[model samples]
Target: MIKRILLALASGALFAVGLVVSGMTQPAKVMGFLNVAGIVDPARFGPWDPSLVFVMGGALLLMLLAFALTPPSRQHPERKPWLADKFELPTRRDIDSRLLLGAALFGIGWGLVGYCPGPALASLLTGGLDAGVFVLAMLVGMALARRWIGRVAA
Candidate 1:
């Protein structure tokens, strides 16, 4: 149990580091980048303020390189415990209403708060009161949702 807890914490620490390094922890910067309104100021530094695009492109390039280096199933048919199964696919056939509804809610929250689920948890490590409040509210919302869904099912 302790080992699992430590592993989880380590993973979270790494994620937080990633968030900080990627500049996702700054709410104002993220909001400015998302809303496409970063270039109007006469005191602005660049012609287009393309820092966000460069960061995103670098992330995408890293992901693509990782995918490219992964060994293909055709080369090694045996499945490893740490690696996902080669032929595993989603069990769903059609787009479910629940999936769509959840995605819409998530997107709206992200847009309004400039903080997605990952970044919210990562922010807790920085020991800020806003992060604490956001996390508490998020947990309460999740609990209420679960209870309401349970009642509806019954």
Candidate 2:
């Protein structure tokens, strides 16, 4: 348990540091990444920042490697994580309102503030006042969404 906890904390800290170093904690960096139109126009939103694209590509590459390396066996069908005894992945494949709403909310929030949960959390920890506000609002939004979704699902 102690090992798992320490591992988790170390992994999270590494992720946070990566975000900071990659400039993900900066709203302008994200906004510049999102400025696809600025790529063609150049005068409107400045040169499109392609650093985030590289970061995302690297992450995707890692994900593909992980998936390729550790795919669960169909014959066994009882895959378990190394640290945990049982690992149950989300089985839902059907696209429902929850999925749609969640995606929409995430995109909108990211566009509006340029701070996704990871970056927001990182920035908040690094003493960014704007990120602090964003994190607080994000927490409130999450709680309200949880209550609403629970009621709806029930």
Candidate with best lDDT: 2
Model 1 alpha-carbon drift over 4 Å, by segment: 1-12, 37-50, 73-89
Mind sharing the TM-score for model 2? 0.84
Report RMSD for candidate 2: 3.0
The residue-by-residue lDDT of candidate 2 on 116-154, one tens digit each, is 999999997788789999999999999998998899889
TM-scores for the candidates: 0.71, 0.84
lDDT of 1 by residue, 42-118 (tens): 25632433566887788799868766676656666553222444546588788877779988998887778778777
Residue 113 of candidate 2: its Cα lDDT? 89
Error of 2 at 146 (Å): 1.7
Worst 10 residues of 1 by lDDT: 78-87
Score residue 88 of candidate 2 by CA lDDT: 71
